[model samples]
Target chain A: MILENNFDLKRMASQVRRDIVRMVYECQSGHPGGSLGCTDYLVALYFKIMKHDPSFNMDGIGEDLFFLSNGHISPVFYSVLAHSGYYDKSELKTFRKLNSRLQGHPTTHEHLPGIRIASGSLGQGMSVAIGAALAKKMNKDQSLVFSLHGDGELQEGQNWEAAMFAPFNKVDNLISTIDVNGQQIDGPTDKVLGLLDLHEKFSAFGWDVMHADGNDMDGIVAALEEAKTRTGKGKPVMILMKTEMGKGVDYMEGSHKWHGTAPNEQQLVQALNQLEETYGDY
Target chain B: MKKYTYTESKDTRSGFGAGLLEAGRKNKEVVALCADLVGSLKMADFIKEFPDRFIQVGIAEANMICMAAGLTIGGKIPFTGTFANFSTGRVYDQIRQSVAYSNKNVKICASHAGLTLGEDGATHQILEDIGLMKMLPGMTVINPCDYNQTKAATIAIAEFEGPVYLRFGRPVVPVFTSPDQKFEIGKAWMVNEGADVSIFATGHMVWQAILAGEKLAEEGIDAEIINIHTIKPLDEKAVLKSAKKTGCVVTCEEHNRYGGLGESIAQLLSTNTPTPMEFVAVNDTFGESGTPEQLMKKYGLDSSNIVDAVKKVMKRK
Candidate 1:
């Protein structure tokens, strides 16, 4: 369902944010900050930007594919995938439970339809996305491959290896976006390890770089659509999506405290009050 | 006693290259990835024939492993080639998460395994690879004896779905196995039958065990020799049958005795059938810069070592 208007996208984003908080609150564990921050971007991609099938297949041959590299934000990924009709939204209740398809970090081990790879250890998703993109090119399928990564994940060396590989091989069918929320578990990414000028870094590595406000649904949708236009031009695309550490709920925005903390009863009530039950709770 | 002979000596890595090309020809879904050791891995021919299907990952084993996992998502069988050390220890987490845990159909082809990697020293040679890989659930570990067996195993794994660790070596060895042999994943090949003692061997050690069997026959000991190619699934039926007949066992491999084929056999026999056993493997220690022959001799992994181990285990029986 291609949601053209901003109203539907915003409503969906609100519902996704509600789902993210509630899922974390139910489990009493999970990263909610990045999930809430990346809600609009995921909403825009699954609803408006990407041409994907709800009836999922492991070999996503003719359809666009998305991989969640920063899998700690599985709250948003699970919510988006469930809302996109990949699985029952009721399954969202079993996020971190034993024998649940939704693992703490996103994984395909349970045969989850939307997840294509297991990703808890950072810096591996870029290579996986590139491989899928290359496979698509080999199969003569023009559909794009998209992936999301965290800015702190850039600390891992494998990402640099993949960053060097994609453009050199002319992997133009890939669009990788980094959630530059600047917050990690210990503290901000700049304090933990400064990621100096990501745009210049990616551009120097031979990628066509773009920037967008990840919190703005309209901006995210426009940037993703524009990224599709940059495809097949002989270089991979990189989007430095700037967003707050947490968005929507008061007292959680712009703070790294909620990065991996589940909301308590009072906090859950406060968050639910802020995010309207647009699509109803699962 | 059954006799074995070879017309020529060949490296197992070349067999992997040949098998890869044939596997690629047989199934177009088979793709090859190398981390800047194309020549060492002997993947030149496969790259030549299917340049489009080949990926040069340029000295990044982690990226190569994860990419291979990704390729499996779109129905492509990706074979990642690198040294045994780099393939396992360097990118263990990558293999664990992306390939093994995810259940991706990725073939991790590793060359230069064990002390047989020769003069590159301890850093390059990996002796604990089998233990590391076998520990992972759902991982199929194979260490073929010679060129022909490696080739057959390479082709066989393409048809079998799941993550596979195919460990081969650098130095040329006797090509005694048949070229047309069918490589079964968990089936053990009985080389010479005897009721005295069962000699279980893998990789380069299999040839040593054969030589030991010949020597033992001359001594009237009558050592039964079995080639255990697949280390993970481990032909338990063959092992139990051989152990039951022989009453004693000896395991030989070019790896640490702590976590190699010997430990797996010991675990099996301790529970089901109690039997006397001796291990002809490197004691828990790192290898040094030396010739393959020198390393094999100094590390107590030669035919003489196997013969000595057989004699020692026969006494326990």
Candidate 2:
């Protein structure tokens, strides 16, 4: 399902943004900030960039795999997974419900089709992606593995442990990206805790580092394609994707307040008006 | 009472390594990962044979655990090797989320368990690993008694799906269990049958319980000895049947008395049978630098301690 045209990709991204805000606003108990921030990148990855299967299997052999390390932004993940045809888009309404598969964090416990690991405690997804990449290399499968992480989540020490592991082992089959939104739940990441020069840090740890604009649909698709070309080299690739805290909505944009807070009904109507509903809403 | 003896003593970790190698030979999906303790974990053989299948994470237990979980996503059975302390406490969140909660088929093989880790002192010795691992939902906890049982368990868990915690020790204990014995996941092995008192033992303490049984036979106590290898899905049927027949119970282990084999049994019996019982374990304290024998004696986990506990428990009965 590779959408090579930029128009189609942007349209899907608009619909995904609609799903993200509606799902969060309907529940009033989800993170809309990071989810909106990472929407274009996920939409591009699932629809255009990555070679994946929507009819998912646990053993995703010979296909590209994506792991959501920073699982708090599950609204975008669930929306993207649904729009990508992994499950019913109507299941999006069940987000954070009692028996719903869409947990507060992305988990494989409920047999969710796309989610392969349970995450939310923070800083565990990289290791899991590396392990899956290692398994791919062992099975002689040439397919690549992709993972996304939050920039604030790098404060955890376990991420550093994985940061050292992937490149040292020449895990060239993995391309991990960090959502550099610079905002956490409390405040800005720089104020909460400084993550000084992630590009230099990851490069020092021996990864081929790249940077891209996460909000731009065309740039994200191009960066992902370029990242694919960089695979099978000596080192694993890291993309420092710079995105806004709240990307689409007007009042939420560039603010840390909406990182986890959902919009009110009037605000949701305003947000929906701001972004045209490209496809029918779930 | 049945007689039990061994001509040689071997560390249970060696059995794990042997079993891992055999499992790797049997199934190519069985991969091994270590946290810079390959020599200590006795994983040299597995690494030597299947270098491509082995991952040396260089002292990152958390990464190793999560990576093991990730490997399962692509249909690989990963066996993570490290000391019990690092295996459980240090990376508990990683195991709880990625492996246990995610239901990944990762075998967490831990060596140097309990006070028997000896001269490594309190920091390295982890007496609460069994409790920590067993508490996780969908985690199968197995503390094998000896070399053969550990090896059998290592191979057996590779076939069984989902998460498992296999705990062994650093000390060279008796290899009394048969080399040909098939390891059942939650089944208890009846070591000896008697009527006075039932002694349930796990890990290194099973051998000590056998010695206690011999001593009790001389005193006409006729202690029933049962080896409880799997601590999580405990064989409640075997435990209650033995308790009903023997009327009294004693539990032996080389772990802390607070949350180890003894507590599991006590919780079971207190609910179901409510039989009088005594525990021979480390009394909720840290272990210091000493020989394995000296630590066992000082911590009241020796065969003599089991004998004393049996006698005292019988009095309560």
Residues A126-224 of candidate 2: C-alpha lDDT, one tens digit per residue? 999999999999989999999999999999999999999999999999999999999988899999999989999999999999999999988988898
lDDT of 1 by residue, B115-161 (tens): 99999999998999999999999999999999999999999999999
Instruction: Please tell me how candidate 2 rates in CAPRI terms.
Output: high
Instruction: Find the 10 residues in a row with the least total lDDT in model 2 chain B.
Output: B308-317
Error (Å) of candidate 1 at residue B4 is 0.6
Using lDDT as the measure, which candidate wins? 1
The docking quality of candidate 2, as DockQ, is: 0.90
Give me the runs in candidate 1 sitting further than 4 Å from their true place: none
Assess candidate 1 and give its lDDT.
0.95
Judge candidate 1 at residue B20 and give its lDDT. Answer: 95
Name the docking class for model 1. high
